[model samples]
Target: MRTQVAIIGSGPSGLLLGQLLTNAGIENIVLDRVDRNYILGRIRAGVLEQGTVGLLDEAKAGKRMHAEGIVHEGTSLAFNGTHHRIDLKELTGGKTVTIYGQTEVTHDLMDRRSETGGATIYNAKNVQPHGYEGDRPYITYEMEGIEHRIDCDFIVGCDGYHGPSRASVPENAIKTYEKIYPFGWLGVLADVPPVSDELIYANHERGFALCSMRSHTRSRYYIQCPSSDKAEEWSDDGFWDELRRRLPKEQAESLITGASIEKSIAPLRSFVAEPMRFGRLFLAGDAAHIVPPTGAKGLNLAASDVHYLFEGLREFYGEGSSAGIDDYSRRALARVWKAVRFSWSMTMLLHRFPENGEFGQKIQEAELDYLVHSRAASAALAENYVGLPF
Candidate 1:
């Protein structure tokens, strides 16, 4: 079989790209190693930058998001036993973020794709891209004990960090940078009302804790712990008690607790692979970069990547210009690096580092104090939080 473009992975990035391409009269096929149910089962961050929301609208997948997603004008930062609010909308000239889960985003895109009858092959094993260096590129995969191949004009890898796309690249052709934090986030998803109207990020003597919500009745909370920690080690009561200890008195008193629907520990890391384009095979999303999730930039970064890639592909097919494709790496990386910096900065400012000792803790608190009190600093945070322009 053959197509104009062959896409790997069925995550939000791949589905969003496929939807955009289908709407543009471009033919593309999506392949994933897992089925749709497993893809949607993965729980991820939910904060949507205005730019991301616009992309969803562009893809015609924003209706349910606009209807069910909560729009937050600002987020709160709690430190030194006090709570401070950063006016994201006011600081960013009316730009705001939407609180829609990533799972919901993927579901919407999948539905849109199915409605349009786009091609997506799931549970294909050993998928690999070949002959991307020259004009011709194709993909090979195994399905149901049969071998198959697809010939396409280009290949896109949205299959995530461990997928075959990045792994297929020669070691010398790519350079990677990574920083693994000493701690990880132990998170819980509960069907309980949020303690605050907006998300709260707390920097306390104990650790860093985040209070986020998917909706009015569903709360997602995280507390920093050692990198070696496991989810089963902490009970619901223990998690709640530790979270309350990290917040201010007012929020702690108002906080509600319940049985957790999901619980896990995610290690914090900042990683990026240089030159997202490898000949005709371009990398997007987790296949190219990763952030600590402190500033909630993971999904937003992927959306920006798809935006750049879609525009490039559109130009190639619509105008017959190679400029966009040629510049995809440079363009995507420029924005990727900025987000990496913002996420790294937020991680440094909010999380407690035991290795840094008392001096580091004091410095972190001092920076947080200055960040909240200074309008310029606060605006900078708000701008990054709402997302940089695409």
Candidate 2:
């Protein structure tokens, strides 16, 4: 098979990229090692930046999102036994974030792609990109013990951190930077009304806790835990009790408890691989970088990468110029590093570090105090939260 572009991984990044390319009349094929149901089964955070919403709209996958997603004008920061709201819209000139689950986003994009008859090969085994360094690039995979090959003008690796896309790059040709946090997030999803209308990010003497929701009736909550903690160890009642202990007096008093529908523990880490493009092969989303979920930047960063990649491909095809593709790595990395910094800062500010001792605790308190009171600091947070210009 021959195509203009061959996409590795069918996650949101690859699916979104495929949709955009299809809309542009570009022929591309998506290859994934897993089936669609497996992809949908993976639970992820929702919080969509305004720019992400626009991309979904451009891909014709925002209908369900705009209809069902809740719009939050601001989010709250809790510390010192009280809540302080940061008006994201006011701070970012009418910008706001949409509370939608990443699962829903993927579902919408998948449906849109299916309706348009886009080519996506699921359960493709041993998928590999070859000859990316030269003018001719192609992908090889196996289906039901039958080998297949796809010749393409370019290859895009949206296959994520552990996928073959990044593994294919020679170690000497790529440099990676990573930091693993001392704690992980023990999260629960329950069908209960949220304690607050907007999300609350709390800093307590014990640890950090976040109050988020998938919808008005489905709440998603998380609390910092030891790096070795396991989800099965915590009971539903225990999780709720601990969460309440971390919040302010009023929110804790009104907080509703229920049986958890889903539970998991996710470790926090920040990782980035430099030079996203290698010859005719390019990396996007988790294939290139990862951020702790503290600032809710994971999915948003992936969308941004897709935005840059799509624009580059579009320019190359529409104008017959290689400038955009040539500059893709530099442009994507600039915004990526900013987000990595923001996520890292937020993680350091909220999480409890026993090793840092009392001095670290005091510094965090002072920074949070200044952030909530100072307009400039609040504006900066709001700007990054709503997302920077694409």
Q: Which is the leading candidate under lDDT?
A: 2
Clashes within 3 Å, all models in order: 0, 0
Q: Residues 1-390, candidate 1, lDDT per residue (tens digit)? A: 999999999999999999999999999999999999998999988999999999999999999999999999999999999999999999999999999999999999999999999999999999999999898999999999899999999999999999999988999999999999999999999999999989999999899999999999999999999998889999999999999999999999999999999999999999999889999999999999999989999999999999999999999999999999999999999999999999999999999988888899999989999999999999999999999998
Name every residue pair that clashes in candidate 2. none
What are the lDDT figures for the candidates, one per model?
0.96, 0.96
* Model 1 / residue 105 / CA error / Å: 0.1
Off by over 4 Å in 2: none
Quick one: RMSD of model 1? 0.6
| Candidate 1 global lDDT | 0.96
TM-score of each: 0.99, 0.99
* Residue 121 alpha-carbon offset, candidate 2, angstroms: 0.6
